[model samples]
Target: MNLKNNIETILGRPLTSDELNNINQFKNQFSIDEDDPLIVVLALVGANKILIEEMPKLLQQKANETIDLHRQTLITQSALIAKDLIHVVASSIDSSKSPIQRATPYLISFFLGGLSLAIALVLVR
Candidate 1:
């Protein structure tokens, strides 16, 4: 059919091998074995009409901005869950006694120093 050449001309580019093959495959809307040129042209015309009419609606449906609220809700929920998990993890970590308490003699020395200084100050007063 001259439709192939016409499409190429409208596109201002030569049809590639893959494009030509696809056009041939989809040339017959129902059966590829059918050789009725008029049927093929009519089918192509009908398909083009459908695309022209439905593409905008389909595209808008897919890219609609109305889902922003749902997306924002999901993000807010996930962030809240993450914040809760962080608090739980931090509390659990802080509750555990570490070996550093025994490993570091500085803690005991600092405590004794503070007590001695307090006692000295009280005795002086």
Candidate 2:
């Protein structure tokens, strides 16, 4: 297959001298066949097309991994908050009982001391 004719047929135009020179340079640099540079060009183009097509999916997978990591971090933070809240509530409940329990004994002792003083005064009278 004539490379120049094939390129002109595909492009629907005549090749410029510069374009032909560039193609010749590319073929020589890559050691492509003299008969058809189209095969090498097509292979390179196809590989680039595949990489372009798969880019979005690869980016989406990376995005999913990032999202999952963020979700796990949030869950762990929520659990820690819940644990701290539970500790606060338990301490409040314990402190609430302590004051009343301590006050009850002091009140009972004061009542008994007043009654004893009143009985001694009545006997003296």
Candidate 3:
């Protein structure tokens, strides 16, 4: 996705040769792995004063939103992992195995349950 081309298309006009050259140079200089390329391009354009100064604010908002989404996802995943751990613990405890086998499973499940609790606590924060 070429940023300049997208901008030009949005404006419904072809950019001048100088603008194209600048955009090309900027693209080479600005290297980042971003989900949304428009944000980075907008920041660069803002730096050159070719776009509004509010670009950074938009970028900040997007970053905050992304962070929030990831946080929620992590918490949800933690809960799921905890649920699975509990299930494993329950099944192991219910098994009709020898006393020694049951003892080991109980000990393992106790530690795993503790780990799951830690993950849940961390995700909550």
Candidate 4:
């Protein structure tokens, strides 16, 4: 493949005149022909540089996605656990208990669930 064409294909655009001149100068300096196998290596090195420059952003995006997923999971788990606790508390309450006593467990469960969700949100950030 033509080195200039290959590099342009990889970059998704045609090279500038200055870029073409630089390639030509390098080839002349190294006594390298246009069809030399080293042209392929040069094109690949250029592609590698582009990929390396983009790598950190790609990794950070994936990391953010993973963190969001974990946060959602934590919130779901907290809500479920709180619901189950409320059910257990309600079932265990005595029928003879006062109205305030019967409502206390539910209030506590809701508070704990909210606290857990807040913690998960903070951790994700």
Candidate 5:
């Protein structure tokens, strides 16, 4: 694990000559070995920096994914409800049945549709 290369990849750029000099000076002054625990700390600090830089974008992306999933769910539910309503309407318009009996299916479908809408509104909130 080359720390310099790792940091450069995370940053999407190479360190400047001055930055390299600084790192060399710090390493020499501390007598830090390549396998030192300090290297782990440095890597962690680099990771934290990248996370901070990309936090907002990451959050927005997650939010968008959630919205898209909800939208798809709503669409699927709506389609299913529409199909149910169509079936109800078809079953309700029976010429052979009495008026009251014919109206029963429509009333039930309307009630169910309203209930579905109410549930959907509640879920959306």
Candidate 6:
């Protein structure tokens, strides 16, 4: 009943050989890519939200564990979105590389605001 391990398991695809070795060797697993990891992490997070609602008894006595799980998922998801925006903002600032450079910040702000609203709705329900 280790929730963190269960969350890691339900993420579906396996990590790379080096990643597995690093994990086994107690090495820190830094993020390798941007979009895919964010998508996968967020998707897993969304699925977890569904599970919490559907299986209420899974959280009865373990209230603190449930809260911790939710908090960790939220923090990971937020960090992923931040990482995604970093690439856009970095490349967009080069006028020659991206004509829409100035718009990226606005896009990121809008996305973050929307995500916040979505999270509020999810939690309130």
State every prediction's TM-score relative to the real structure. 0.31, 0.42, 0.43, 0.63, 0.51, 0.30
Candidate 4 on 1-125: residue-level lDDT in tens? 68889888988888778777866676688887777899888887765665687699999999999988888887787678767766776688777979899788777767776676677667656
Q: What are the lDDT scores of the predictions, listed in order?
A: 0.55, 0.59, 0.67, 0.77, 0.72, 0.55
Off by over 4 Å in 4: 7-34, 98-100, 119-124
Cα RMSD of all models vs. native, in order, equals 19.3, 23.9, 13.5, 4.0, 6.5, 23.8
Stretch of 10 with least lDDT, candidate 2: 116-125
Cα lDDT of model 2 overall?
A: 0.59
Top candidate by lDDT: 4
lDDT of 2 at 59: 100
Runs with alpha carbons beyond 4 Å of true place in candidate 6: 1-60, 95-125
Candidate 2 vs 6: which has more TM-score: 2
Encode model 3's per-residue lDDT on 1-125: one tens digit a residue: 55665657655667678767766676567653334566456545534554454479989999999988888887778767877776777685746877887787767866787787677668667
Candidate 4, poorest ten consecutive residues by summed lDDT: 116-125
TM-score of 2: 0.42
What C-alpha lDDT does candidate 4 achieve relative to the native structure? Answer: 0.77
Clashing pairs in 3: none
Task: Evaluate candidate 5 by giving its C-alpha RMSD to the native, one decimal.
Answer: 6.5
Ranked candidates, highest lDDT first: 4, 5, 3, 2, 1, 6
- lDDT winner between candidates 1 and 5: 5
Error of 1 at 88 (Å): 6.0
Candidate 1 clashing pairs, residues 3+ apart or interchain: none
How does candidate 3 score on lDDT? 0.67
Candidate 1 segments whose C-alpha is farther than 4 A from its true place = 1-36, 65-73, 76-78, 85-125
